[model samples]
Target: MKLLLLNLIFLSGSAAAVELNADGILNSLIDEFVSCVNDSAGPIHQAAMRLFWLLVPINLVISGIRCVFNGDFSDFFFSLVTSVLFTGIFYYLLSHDYAIGKSIIDSFVTMVDDDYMGPSELIDLVFNIDRQINNLMTSNVLGLVSKLQIVICMIVFSVVMFFVILRFVSIYLTAQILCVIGVFVLGFGGLKATRYLAVNYLKLLISKGLELITVLIITKTGCRILNDVIDATKLYEEGLSVLKHSECMVMIFISLFIFVLSKSLPPVMSSLMSGTSGGFETGLGLSLKKYRFLISRNSGK
Candidate 1:
């Protein structure tokens, strides 16, 4: 039994180690190595590797500032990462001849086969995707309508939350304010007697207000997140329009495509063209030489 197991292991390992064709293996290795190098380089090219590394701290600082103002640091982080991933995926789909679209289609078919989400669920997902896509090409009038909707909804929701917070905060502040007024009304003798009492009362009120406001702002932003999707739609439209108007859309796409194609095409085309040109030059040289030799022979004879 041990001998059979050992033999089986050895046979499997040997099969796994089967040699690949020299040229094919070399080409594949080079393509993969190039991709690895580029991935390691991050956003910029090889020359800016250090610069890109430096941007990491800068990005963190920016995120911190955003968090301070918005108080939704977690949401900010989520949006940042999601946007980067989405843009990278979109750029690949638009620029490359890698059949990314076909892969997406295949995945949908596979999902149906796997009985993951039902057809109705898939249809709802498609509708949401359509809404997002349509949101991009949407006109300013439509954008205004959407923004208005968000504004009204957020304003209403934020007001409700703010007031709920305000009610609690007001109770504390009102008590403190009333006590302060009480001190003034009662005179220095009364305040001196109740100094500790007054300070404690004010401290409690301020602390409660701080806590309530923090919760209120965080809750408000959380409620506004769905509306911010519309904001994203507006931003995307502006960015795409700028690229389109600048006539750089095609160029940008081609530039990105070349990054992928650089692995496969440039060297191949260069070699093929060089060989073809060399052959043509050689044929022309030979023909000219043969004509001269024939002419000389005829003249001498």
Candidate 2:
């Protein structure tokens, strides 16, 4: 029941792009996504700088105190040293407007724009395709079915194109939110019990990177099909049905095929690599398990 409803939602525009920039939609979206990330990330960097002075030392002291209670003197010494070194490295990476963070974000965008989609080639192709559809819409010779085919292809293709770019907005924004909060989680690094919280945060960053790589492969395939559609659209001319030019039928089916893959591929790709994030036992994980057991026990009482 829920699955059917989910499929219905997937077909809707909300699954893809919220807003389309008809003027320079694709590139403008790409540009805007990059812009929004840089803007939101600024105050985060500044706040981290401020907190570097205040919270890091405090966290270290707390960790050091906890270490004394939890471990031997040698263990506490090494943990403090390790925490200081790790924190220093993290701070350096985040310094200068989060060069590391922004670089990671840029790499994802590059994979879509520069690599998979082929910037001008892809965008120019979309424009060319849109212009052809415009021509067909203007043509009085084409019947309803023919016109509907072209219109559906154009709409689905546009959605997939915009979705491919806009998808990163959610990712980058989530990453920004994580950074703002996750910086403090790094403080737990010195304590063995809660250290996994910090480790998991790093793991999540890598997971997002890996997710982009998967999306890049999907985008590459979609763009290639789109390129073929461009070639097929050339087969159209005055008063000719797709029956006469079978290329139009083939093109419509394949273009529609892309929209299905756009929704289906991510979950398939993610499932195949399900072990990427989990599979490790951490002190925090163990503590959470114990905590949950006690909560359940108290509820039974």
Candidate 3:
């Protein structure tokens, strides 16, 4: 009897532990994921910072010589001061683990809440929506056509969200890397190369800023729409009518609109950066063209 009682006690303890584990699983997972990313990025950031510091002196010497040859003493002095300030500021920020990418991510998380749902949470929500629709259809709670439409809407929403997440991550990483390496490349390269590199880097920075803003807008809007859908589901569970045909259609249209924007925005950003938009040139491109035109006109005179 004592052995049987001990076994029962063990089973009860195990059940309680399982319940606790399940309750904390999502938070645990998120914490570990963030920790892993920080750990992995730390070494790369350090190496990049070191390389940048090493290149700074060499770049400044070259730039100084070129400026003197061009009779631009004032330009050389300005560049020197700016370079020193930029390096010091970035070094301090990087040493404290406060990269621009991390700042952007933190801003996004805070924009929602402490309990912001990431891509994984979004995927789970999609799955739940699909499952709920399936159950409703199987129970004859909704018409077949209506159920199918809702299912399709869920799928499209999931696909668009997935693509958005993928694109955002890619752009964030690319921008961070470019910003890190761009200074060295522009500084070491000749006058023409420096001019081009500066233009490109500026364009990239602007594009990245725009992408983050777009992400913020979409995330806030999508979350609000999702919450409404979730509330509707709760009402339906309470025996209220929900998932009307018109609602399903609207959801599908919204998802498609988001998908189109996600796919199209990046290309438009690229075109703008390259100054390839029909008849609309970026300031950098126009400035370069004007500079060349003036130089040629002076040479002819």
Q: Specify the highest-lDDT model's number.
A: 2
lDDT of 3 by residue, 1-301 (tens): 2233224334553443323332343334334334434555655556656655666676678768877998855557655655565456445544544355455544634565445654445545555666666666666665335655766777776666656555544554455554454434433222322334434544556666566556545555555666676667666555577557777777677666765776676566556546643221245446555765686679679
* Models, CA RMSD each: 38.4, 10.5, 11.1
**Which regions in candidate 1 have their CA more than 4 angstroms from the true location?**
1-179, 182-203, 206-233, 236-301
Residue-by-residue lDDT tens digits, candidate 2, 173-255:
45555555555555454344455665676666556655555655555676687777666556654433432334445555664
Clashing pairs in 1: none
- Tell me how many clashing residue pairs each candidate has: 0, 0, 0
TM-score of 3: 0.55
- Compared with the true structure, model 1 gives a TM-score of 0.20
Full candidate order by lDDT, most accurate first: 2, 3, 1
Which of 2 and 3 is the better model by lDDT?
2
TM-score of every prediction relative to native: 0.20, 0.63, 0.55
The residue pairs found clashing in candidate 2 are none
- Where is model 2 more than 4 Å wrong at Cα? 1-23, 63-71, 108-124, 137-165, 168-198, 238-252, 267-301
After TM-score superposition, the amount by which residue 192's alpha carbon in candidate 3 deviates from its true location, in angstroms, is 11
Error of 1 at 116 (Å): 47
Tens-digit lDDT string for candidate 1 (1-301): 2232224333544444333432233223323333433343223222222332344345556656776789864546553653344334323322332233224323423432343332222223323433654554354423233554433443443334323333323332333333233222211111122223323333333333333333333323333432443454456566643212222223233223322332333234334323333332235446655765686679679
Candidate models: Cα lDDT each:
0.36, 0.55, 0.54
